[model samples]
Target chain A: MGRWEPNARGRLEQAALELYVERGYEQTTVAEIAGRAGLTERTFFRHFADKREVLFAGAGTLRDDLVSAAAQAPPGAPPIDVVATALAAVAAPFQGRLESVRRRQSVIEANAELKERELIKLASLSAALAETLRERGVAEPAASLAAEAGIGVFKVAFGRWVGEPGGGEFARIVREAVDELKAVAAGS
Target chain B: MGRWEPNARGRLEQAALELYVERGYEQTTVAEIAGRAGLTERTFFRHFADKREVLFAGAGTLRDDLVSAAAQAPPGAPPIDVVATALAAVAAPFQGRLESVRRRQSVIEANAELKERELIKLASLSAALAETLRERGVAEPAASLAAEAGIGVFKVAFGRWVGEPGGGEFARIVREAVDELKAVAAGS
Candidate 1:
């Protein structure tokens, strides 16, 4: 939010990933990344606040997409459906980019610290979803439960969408996942 | 697993919460906690791995309860229902302890590091749930999805139960949460 530098952001992300792969998240330094990006340390700061920021820097964009989609869903939509639509909207950027998604997940997997941060990010998203549902007049506990359930579905769908060979469409997989939840809840 | 000292374990937990509330999680140390509990730091380590563990050092018991319950759910139980039943069994020890829970939650809320650790713990629980679901013939994504959704219901119910002055019951709230998910799935 401070200094607005467009190209530096992408440059920093790529640089961070390269270093993370070659060295490690802990071993990678902001200064080293900025140098690789042909930018000064301050320039790197202009985009990401810290080394960890490079990993989660796009969370805001995804969060906004999720919230906006939920907001735009039809008036009578249930909380889970609204969250599903939001996840679909957010999946567009990652769709067909399995290699990148896998790499990001790999980085997160190699370190428990990174995994904890990722978990916190997911928790925050669920909280946001619950808040949005509450704003829509959903009752206590339902809004939060529905939001958490939706995130669970998203986690499952995304993991499959990225891990499977020639993975099916991201949106399609998510829709099917939702239907599966419905079936489980209804059928059993 | 180290010292088979049950009362010592309880003492360490009580001391940790007192200090965390008095000083802070980061500021508190294993030695200080042990001293307060009239034990050596070695005894504290013998009971729990470290300072952070004092809060949920009972995870081993909780896990056993969950696994045993999941192992025993009716063979034909649905994925969500199975997970829900397991969660209910695991939450039994936590019943009638709302005041203690609210205090623990406050300590967690005050510390980001603690919250992060809590998230990691939840992720582990979710993975365990997925594994248990696999033993029941649930497919890959379905197993993970059902597990995560079950965690969702647990979180929502636990959140409400602890916050309510006279929450009906932990198991009751959990069932209510599952019912809400069913209603949402069928609602829109």
Candidate 2:
């Protein structure tokens, strides 16, 4: 039904996620995903390198946007503020996609391979963000520390946003997480 | 040369790390490592399930020690302090093994599969640490936030200890990293 769909990439992803949730990630195959999307295996391959790519396709853009946002922040802004702004900016597009994000996370959590890939992607993003902080003249340990803390806040906030019913905007949740992180660090 | 050696595990690990660094992680084989250690392949298997295990043999103990330290921290101690103490405890044993750690890190960094495994192990350690924090009455986001920050500190400190000559004791570096984390968080 979706083979001829205007947004073939989106349709293929939805089909893959639905299939993965129903049959489990390992049990789902590219052919089945394509069939469910009313597309062909060729089309599926064209859109995603593999089933795993469907879940991780956004990672590249997310990393790029986060680095750019941090790099473009005012030079005098505090490291945490710069990181928080970067997180907020990158998180803006995730708004209104809570259900999708939730489904994807569950699928990832259920599979070890997917979980490893997710962690690696997150690590890569953190490294890129840290590099941007360094570019802004942030010192060693501080740059890496800020970047890791930023990712940690993003993870905690994203988990809450996806799991809670009618969760508030993603950016707001991230802000709360950043505040909590500072408090946690300060031993408050 | 090492067949009759009393410390079979240590001999095998040293042989494996040498082979891995000299021949690359992928090029080194279990048989080669065993031969280098002057032990039969059977003995190597007796010690480690596989080549990768030789590199990760410490992960389980590291996780256990970290959790125990966190769990036993003085009641009412701050979460970050608890985490810092846990990290220091786990890092103590690594103080005199800087060269070994550096060799292993270089091998891990050179191979994508090994790198993924390393990240996954670190993530597991973080989860266990966070759970211990929860047991100590730290709440949701704070537990995870503190744990991630602690791991961040450990990673930064460990990298420095392994890469820099006379980097000082592992525990001291951990303490410095923890301080930097707090400063980074407070935007000092």
Candidate 3:
């Protein structure tokens, strides 16, 4: 549903990841990242609050898209169903960037701070999803249940897509995971 | 399933809460907390890893209990049902400390770091639940689904309990939440 900053963001991310791989998240300087991308540190700082934020900048956009997608879903749809669609709507962005996504995951998984940031991001997203459900008139526990369940689906499917053979097509795994959640809930 | 060092932990917790309320989490030093509790800083550190640990010492133990309880549920029980039972296992401890729990929640809700710790604890508990399901021979995705759904129930019920007029007992709300999840999953 969105991009971070069009071409500039993409360039910074690519340059940053390359340096992080060659060096490391801790070793890579923001200035060097900007220099490698043929951009100034001022440009990098303008886009990212910190070096770590380069990896997390998309989270805000994703949250916004999720809210919009949930709003645009068919009226009165079940919470999980609406959340599933919202997740699906964001899948296309990942499809073309599977390699980069995996690279980002690799970097985050290796750093405790990045991992904490990810957990915080996930928690906020779950809360946002719940808010969407509440706005749709779903009651307390059910809205929370659906939201957490949606986050669960997202978490597991993302993990699988990262590790599964030829699983870079995130949309398919996400759809399958949603179906699996339903089947499991149906006590399959 | 386990007592938190009998009355010492609870007493210390109450004392700590009082200090936090009167002062604040940041301003209240360990010495002040110990003085309020009639204990020493060494005693406090023995029970908790750090200042923040006092707010979270029960969660790890609680998560282990929940996972063990779920794993031991009847073979024929649905995974979600098993998770519900596991979650309900804490009803006794929670009920006994409803007021204290509410006080803790208020303290925690007022702090970002505490909330992050809570989210991380919940995430870890969710992962543990999934692992237990897998051990019970539940298939991939099913285990994850049951775990996530269980967490959903726990969060909803916990919120409902916290909102009760006189501060609700944890068990009753959890039981009701389990039923609510069952109802929603059944599309009732």
Query: Which candidate number maximizes DockQ?
Result: 2
Q: Model 3 residue A109 lDDT?
A: 89
lDDT tens string, model 2, B62-168?
Answer: 99999999999999999999998999999899988888888999999999999999999988888999999999999998999898878878888888888787857
Residue A45, candidate 1: Cα error in Å is: 2.1
After aligning candidate 2 to the native by TM-score, how far in Å is the CA of A96 from where it should be? 0.8
Per-residue lDDT tens digits of candidate 3, residues B108-158?
Answer: 888888877788888889899999999899888789877887787788788
State the lDDT of candidate 2 residue by residue for A142-185, as single tens digits.
Answer: 99889888887888888888888887899998998999999998
lDDT of 2 at B161: 86
Give the range of the ten consecutive residues with the poorest summed lDDT in model 3 chain B. B1-10
- The DockQ of predicted model 2 stands at 0.82
Ranking according to TM-score, highest score first: 2, 1, 3
lDDT of 3: 0.81
Residue by residue across A1-188, what tens digits does model 3's lDDT show? 13434677778889999888789899999999999988888888877888988898899998988888988889988777787899888775788777888889999888877877898898788899889888988988788877777787888889988887776678778878878877776767
Each model's TM-score, in the order given? 0.92, 0.96, 0.92
Model 3 docking category: medium
Task: Give residue A126's lDDT in candidate 2 (0 to 100).
Answer: 88
Model 1 / residue B132 / CA error / Å:
1.0
Instruction: Give TM-scores of chain A for all candidates.
Output: 0.90, 0.95, 0.92
